[model samples]
Target: MKTLIVIPTYNEGSTIERVLNTTLEAIEGDILVVDDNSSDATKELVRNFFDTGRVFMLERPSKLGLGTAYIYGFRWGLSRGYDLFFEMDADNSHNPAALPWFLKELRGGYDVVVGSRYLHHTISVVGWDFKRLLLSKFGNWYAATLLGLKQFTDLTSGYRCYTSKALKAIGLEKIKSNGYAFQIEMVYRSHRKGLKVAEMPIIFYERGGGGSKMSRKIVREAMALPFKLRLEAIRHIFKDNI
Candidate 1:
């Protein structure tokens, strides 16, 4: 498959370079950095790799949400006939060393391959304090239970790979969540669309640089999105039956 890894960035100048270097070394796929007009040197850092002939960038006007950044990248990849796509963070938290595993799973016929911090009841996270860990665990539980995605161990994991078929099946334009909820919605839509979803265990380290983007607004949106998706599903079923 012709793979394209889409990394979303916003003010991650400190870690973006390392992430790019490692990602280039770790996989054979080309990279597309979807930058949301990072005020810092994020864009410049990514541009530095353009001479490699495999690195690309799509610059947005302002600081758009995470979901939009990815959607933009997906559309770009699809238009150019890329076969596989990836969602990775600019933070070093999502290790580039695991990209090969994700690609392997996708090649093995999984429509969506999720890199999970908690897979099969094991927590593989590092650098998080107890409270942060608890919050992540509880958040996953809450999302999985409400969204009927309990089979997935980590619903909010941002590190994932999607075959082009899965991306096409999910109707990307209809994805409305712009925060971490975007991750949950992708899996939920994949499940609802009958795509094969597989989980891969990965060790998630806290970001080495840049401030955390988590905010109360993003958290509130994540909390509300599962219900919204559930209701939408119900409405679709009702409409279909009627």
Candidate 2:
């Protein structure tokens, strides 16, 4: 199976090289770095990997939303006839070692596999303070509860793999969120569309460098998106009955 790992990066020069090397070592796949215009040496660092031939980079004009970057990468992979696509972080928060496990699950006929830090009532995160941890837990609980997606333990986890069939089935054009909420929305849409979704436990390490992209705007968007999604589903049901 031809797999493409799509990493969205912004000012992550401090860790991009190591992330690329480790990811390439872990899986038999090509890597695509979707870099938002960064002031740092992130782009320069990514270019250094191009000699490997399996690494490619796409430069955007500016810092686009994370969801849009993945969507861009997904489309790029799809056009190139890739079978599977992955969402990974460039800051090394996501372990590349778990990639083989995700691919195994996909080969076993699952459409989407989420690498979750909280699978089966267990918290498997490190390097986070209590307040941060509480926010993450509460956010997951809030989204899952409101969207009737309690079956998933980490709806907002960005570490995930999806088959090309699953991506097309979920209707990429129909996805609405463009921030962190995008993760929650994708899983919800996949489940609603009858795709098989599985979660595997993973240890999430906090970023070793650079600041978080999380802003008040992103948080607010995440907070309100579930209600919007729920309302949309209800409206769809009502329309069908009419």
Candidate 3:
């Protein structure tokens, strides 16, 4: 089955081309970059790289949030007949060479495969402070506990593979949240729909080229996530009664 990797980018001029080249050379499918109209030369760089197929870009008017970027890209990917869909980090933290493992596992009859950093005794995150690690760890624990999803290790993991079936089950129409929490909510909703999920241990190296997108605002949203997710789950379960 053919696959499409959707990378959402914002002001990644310093690293976009190298990341694209890395993915295109290592993987066996289309890499569609949903650029958030980065103020830099991100869109232009991709456009000039290829005069044709495989590597493509969709330019938005401005920074439209990560959730919307992926949602737009997912819809675009579905329309193109890509049987499998993927979301990955663009700053080289998510290894392009490891992509085949996700596809191979998906072919082995799983609906979704997550590249997890906390599984199988692998603490593969490189170059992170303890405080940042603690924040992610606590946030992930709270999200999974509140939502009752047991399959996901890193609830906010951006590296994942989805069969067309699983993606359809998500019904992007239902997902909320803009950045980090978006990943957590997707995993929760996928579990609710009974999609089979598997995890592959991976090294989530910290981004080497540019500043992280995470901000104080995103952290505050993530902190409130457990309570928010629980309430949403309860509402979804009782929507028919209301």
Instruction: Count the clashes in each prediction.
Output: 0, 0, 0
lDDT of 1 by residue, 1-242 (tens): 79999999989999999999999999998999999889999999999999999999999999789998999999999999999999999999998999998877776778999999998789999899999999899999999998878899998999999998999999998999988899989999999899999999999998999988888888899999988987888899999999
- By summed lDDT, the worst window of 10 consecutive residues in model 1 runs over 101-110
In model 1, the clashing pairs are none
**Against the true structure, what is each candidate's TM-score?**
0.98, 0.97, 0.94
**C-alpha RMSD by candidate, in order:** 0.9, 1.0, 1.6
Per-residue C-alpha lDDT of model 3 across residues 44-83, encoded as one tens digit per residue:
8888767648888888888878888888988998888889
Off by over 4 Å in 2: none
Taken over the whole model, the C-alpha lDDT of each candidate is 0.92, 0.93, 0.83
Name the lDDT of candidate 3. 0.83
Q: Give the C-alpha miss distance for residue 109 in model 3, angstroms.
A: 1.1
Question: How far in Å is the alpha carbon of 238 misplaced in model 3?
Answer: 3.5
